[model samples]
Target chain A: MGEAIVVTSGKGGVGKTTTSANVGTALALLGKKVCMVDTDIGLRNLDVVMGLENRIIYDLIDVAEGRCRLNQALVKDKRFDELYMLPAAQTKDKNDISPEQVRKIIEDLKPDFDYVIIDCPAGIEQGFRNAIAGADQAIVVTTPENAAVRDADRVIGLLEKTQIAPPKLVINRIRPSMLRNGDMLEVDDICQVLAIDLIGIVPDDEVVIKAANQGEPTVMNPNSRAAIAYRNVARRILGETVPLMHLDEKSGVFRRVRKFLGMG
Target chain B: MNGKSSITIKGVKEGLVFLLDDQCDFVTLLDELHAKLDKHEQQLAGPLVHVYVKLGARQLDEEDKERIRAIIRKQGNFLVQTIESDPVAEEAADYASYRLHTVAAMVRSGQTLEHDGHLLLLGDVNPGGTVRCTGDIYIMGALRGTAHAGCAGHEEAIIAASLMKPTQLRIADIISRPPDEWASAEPWMEYAYLADGAMQMDKLTHLHHSRNKVLQAKGV
Candidate 1:
């Protein structure tokens, strides 16, 4: 059976849905049969992020409530032959579905796909529980802010209590300029607080927002810094070792110059 | 003689000692005690005399103690100061407060690991994570979260961590200054404690000077 991964962050507005969409897209692009499940229910955004919102005729609640079969509810991503999207119900709240139902849906999808990426809702409530119920692995997304890091730490603690493998952290929305100016919390600091393995670091790039506005994942644009980070995270999920991208803009030029001189 | 009393009364310096026979039935003992007090009513009527009742091997519940107290109250000028049993009840298993509990797991944010006694954590206390103990708390890793040592009103409790950057530190009832005031990059394990009702911080090595009991060991 394929593994199911949940992208969750305890606090809201921490890019969990964005990470889920991009990572799922990257996995599909890497020749893995990937299925993205939106467990956010009433507050679903994964469909919109994947640009599959208009194509969704049946959703998670429809399949859960036996109104439609699992395959019928899965919306195919026309861009990638291997990618699929299981949109959440817009009318039903998180409490409408139970963890057992979510687990069953994930289990059903796992055998048909190489990877199941679940987009979790914010907060440690019923929605979060439903999202993680069937996940074999977890990705905790957080920003560099103290509040986001704090919430990420809380979510990590909760994730540890679950059967999922120790959740890897994805530090999203990192601003290298703010970091250099000492105005933002460093990646090291966030890692120190959460005490988890770092899976990826996506910098604060305007491209992510622009792509989202167009209902497209940033990973579609290979030149975007955030896109590279998400792709690296997907490769890491496939057990590939990729060096972290140089986030310091000035240091990249300095290091390139030093390498070119070769001490001459 | 078969008519012999099962209760004996003696006068000590502080009070009157009533030695109740353990072998007799409780009802018989109470009857004999009442009779004895009634017999000495005239002699016991002087000043307000303290009465101490000793139950040799008898376990008296609260109701039984109240019954005995009521009987003594019936006797004029007698105040029941103490009602004790020879076999002391085992103290509740509060040994947890004295024992050191070792946990080898990260205390992540929004999670609280509480111990009745001292806590020795092998992993980090991440921000928003809390580790509370009735006694001292020792962490082998970073403590970026909140550590409340002596949570159960133990003012002498101390919280020590390898990396002492915590969101908040609480010892007993005293909370530390805001996280800004405690921001330090000193590359030494540090500890926080209450001194004179105020929070104090110092290097871990100097802990022995303030709390010698922490290092002291008693053996047979």
Candidate 2:
């Protein structure tokens, strides 16, 4: 059975949605039959980021309410051979679906997919609990900002409250130049504060916004450094030990994409 | 006044107000309304003006309102603005809709909050979320989403947010822009309204209901 991993960040706007889309797309690109679920009802972006919003006939609510079968709500992503997404209902509130209902929905999804990465909404509310309810694993996305780190710690405590596996951390939008200039917080500082295992450190790239505006995930962008990092995170999720991307001040990102993809 | 007059049409500062007689048969009321507007069709042609239908205490069938709308359209280029019931019935409607929904959580993208009357939100309305209400909307947190107040075409409706940076806001029949104009106005709770075919944003504390007594109200 495919393991369900939830991408959550207690803090808002720290790249949880972006990480979910990229990491889930990377997993699917690695020949896994992957399904990405948007548990962030009301404020959903997985389908829009994946460029599959128009294909959604039924949604998570439809499946939970038995208005449609589970497969009927899964929108197939033609970007890859084995990728699909379960979109959240745009017109519904977060409280409309309970955690128990989500658990049952994921239970039905687990049989057909290899990796079910759920894109969770922000905050530690009903939507957050519902997103984490069905996951076998959790990936907490955060930035090096102190507020984000504090929220990530709180989220980690909440995950432990539910007795799931130790949550992994992905420090997104890392600005190495800023860190070197002593303007931004370092990855080690965030890791020390949050006290979680590091999964991925994504660099701040303008291409992410550009790709998102085009309705494409950054993982598919061969030229993006964040894409390479996301693919490495996907490998780590698959139990592959990959070194973190070294942020060099001189060579920067000129010669990394070829070297990153050549290894796979 | 015509002997069979059941529809009273009068000009006001806002536009035109029509009072539908409560005792008249629905069909006769509609017939008189159509005839009166058709007689003045030439005078009511190009410029679209607001039209309010006052139905005292009687609640007509919803389809009856639609038929009235069709008759108005067939006669002139008037926009049916609001259909207000009697004061007692309005009080009862308010009581029926007194369950003011409050979402004590952050509203995220693809989510929408809809209520019949006033909607009170204690969380941030993030981008991609939408909050709509037929009455006034009060957001205790930042409103970065799309908010449509007075969605049922009540011109007197207002939207107030603690930190107002909405993507778009609508009050009554007017849609507002200039979200960036008030980026510095977030710290102050802001409300929106429509004046002279354009949206006006002001501090919530200064929001005044522009209502008058029935006769003076009729002049407006």
Candidate 3:
């Protein structure tokens, strides 16, 4: 059985799609069998971000409604043999999906994969509920901005109400220079306001944009700073006691990765 | 029946009197008193009808007092004169010792609490939720929300939360606004109290800080 993780953010455009794609790729590179599901039914973008949009012959709606099997709808990653994706249906609305159906799909995929990361839709509606229904853990993604942090705080409250304890935090798109100048909220400020254990802090990098546009997750490009951060986060999820990465510098990917892997 | 009237009156010369005993059923006693009053119905009832209810000293707990009040109010036509068997001063002292402290099972977001004594909450205090306590405030769940403690100027009063990440915490006249940075640290119990003439938070331990609690309840 695998860990079903839901990448959720209450506010839109806070890098949930980017995080899911990169983290899923990172975990698969570590030799873990991974499946990424896009729960944003009508507004699907995970497939596009992963560059698997043209290859989707069937969507989650078809598999859920029994028109096609789960395996037939899964789009295998071209770069990684262990990575696969179940893209959301752009034509279908969130109401067409149910938590029970999502749970059944994740349960079916559990024994075959080591990780199933669900990309949650924005807002605290049916779409959000559907994404978390099949998951064991939640990764709340937020930015350094107040609006994103506030929305993340609200989502944390809702998860607590649903009895999902200790949902980890991922602060995405952190600009260190702005933070140093007191222009952006620092990591400590976000944690203090959100009050959750942090899992990852992906710095704002041009490599992330370049990699996403190339249909390759930034985590695959070992030279990328955001990729190294995602790799450290994956190790943390695997129960490693890696010290936090320094987001200030753009150097030391190998040294930090070794330190994270306990080989340093 | 002790008195010949529907309202069985007991006279106490020194203090207020109430007669509630285990030997006599309250219903039967009421019925017999009413019968006696019916027998003496020939006398025209005057103004100021005083019906004294006798409650024993031993039966002065919450349940018995509420029951007696309920029964008296239900019994029509009786202008009941209720008296406590226990001394009022002693009762007031006891009541003051243990004030009303109730924490709802689920304290949702936007919920506010203004309590006098020790406030103990069992659920998580989410962000935007607030709890203001005059005495010590103890939350069994995570305190990731906002809280105000020792609001009545009890500086010695401490606020303890299971997991403290309050946006703003006020103790006495001091407030601690959360620093603008992420705190990558392990979860630990946090206790906030007055220190160095301001509010301070420290890990929960058997540590002591000698600070004067300025509680001005009387004209000094």
Candidate 4:
């Protein structure tokens, strides 16, 4: 059976949808059959991010309510034949679906795909519960901001209470220049606070917004740093050992000099 | 009337002590107090005299104490300083407040862990997390959250952490200075406490030296 992975962050606007879209696209590019599920319900945006918004005929709610078959609700990605997306209903709220129904849907989808990527909603309410219901593993996305890190810690705590394995962390939108200036929280600091394995780190790139605005996942743009980060994350998910990308070479030199001077 | 007296008045440096008979009935005690006050009306007609009431083994509720205050008010020259009773049985909640609870889980953001007594945590307290205790709080890991020791108004309670980088610290009702003041990370473990009604921080090594009783082990 395929492994179900849920992408979530307790706070809103921390790149949960973007991470889901990019990671799913990257996995498909790696020759794996992938199904992306948008569990945000009324606030669904994964379809738009994956450039599949125009093709959705039926939605997740319709499939769960038995109004349509699961295959009927899936929208095919334009670039990859192996990648499919199950859109959320724009009219339905998160309370409309129960965790058991979500679990059932994921179970049915698991047999056909190698990876089922569930994009979770922002809050720790019903939507979060429904998204994690069928997830065997979880990826907690967070930014370097204090509020985002705090929320990610809360999400990790909640995930630990579930049957899913300990969640991996993805620190997104890091600004290397700000990090060098000592204005942003360091990657080590975020890791120390969350105390979870770091799966990937995506730097702050303007191309992410540009690609998303064009209704394409950032991973489709090979030149973007965020795209490479997502691809590395996908490789890690496939059990490949990839070294963490260097955020900045100057910061490394600065840190080494400080250590040499015994001022670190 | 029996020859033995039920109420005795003694003069001390600070005030006049009224030792009430604990074995007597409540109504009888009140009557005797009234009679004694009336008999000594002339002696009580002087400058304001502090009166201290001592109930050896008796417990008086709020209404009963008010009654005693009213009776003493009849002697206009007397000021009721205090009314005290011997120690009584403690409630279960109070007893639980003296316990030490050890927890081995991280207190995550938006999560609060409260204990009736002291709290000993084995994991980090992430930012936005809260830990409240009636006594003291001892964190074996980093404390990046809010910690409130002596939540029940114990001024002597303390909070100690291996890495003291908390967002906020409170001892009893006194809050610490802003997070900016506590931004630096000291090399050694540190603790926060209330000293002279103000919150203060120091190395954990000096805790026993400052508050000798804090390190004393409880007797079985």
Colliding pairs, model 3: A187-B182, A188-B181, A188-B182, A188-B183, A189-B181, A189-B182, B18-B54, B19-B54
**How do the residues A137-172 of candidate 1 rate in per-residue lDDT, one tens digit apiece?**
999999998888878878887888889999999999
Q: What is candidate 4's CAPRI-style docking category based on DockQ?
A: medium
**Interface RMSD computed for candidate 3 is what?**
3.8
After superposing candidate 4, which stretches have Cα over 4 Å from the reference? A250-264, B1-99, B180-184, B211-220
Model 2 chain B weakest lDDT span, ten residues long:
B89-98
Model 3 off-target regions past 4 Å? A163-165, A249-264, B1-127, B132-220
Name the runs in model 2 displaced over 4 angstroms: A249-251, A254-264, B1-220
Clashing pairs in 2: A42-B109, A42-B110, A42-B111, A43-B108, A43-B109, A44-B109
Per-residue lDDT of model 2, residues A50-147, tens digit only: 88888889999989999999988999997887999999998998999999999998888899999999899999999999999899999999998877
Question: Residue by residue across B88-138, what tens digits does model 3's lDDT show?
Answer: 422232222535465854343555767877788876676667888777788
Distance from true location, Cα of B153 in model 3, Å:
18
Please give, for residues A1-264, the per-residue lDDT of candidate 3 as tens digits: 898999998999999999999889889988899999999999999998899999999988898999999999999999989999999999989999899999899889888899999999999999999998888899999999977887887787788766555699999998877877889998997786566799999888777887788888889878667888999889888898877878667446645655654666
**By TM-score, how accurate is candidate 3?**
0.61
Give the clashing residue pairs of candidate 4, or none. none
Off by over 4 Å in 1: A250-264, B1-97, B179-185, B212-220
What fraction of native interface contacts is shared by candidate 4?
0.71
Arranged by DockQ, best first: 1, 4, 3, 2
Candidate that would win on lDDT: 4
iRMS of each prediction: 1.1, 9.5, 3.8, 0.9
Backbone-clash count (model 2): 6
Q: What does candidate 1's lDDT look like per residue over B1-220, in tens digits?
A: 2887678889899988998888889988887778877887898888899999999989989999999998999987999999988865323435344788899998886788988888999999887788988888999998878899877677888888888888899998888855555666788878887889988788889987865655546695
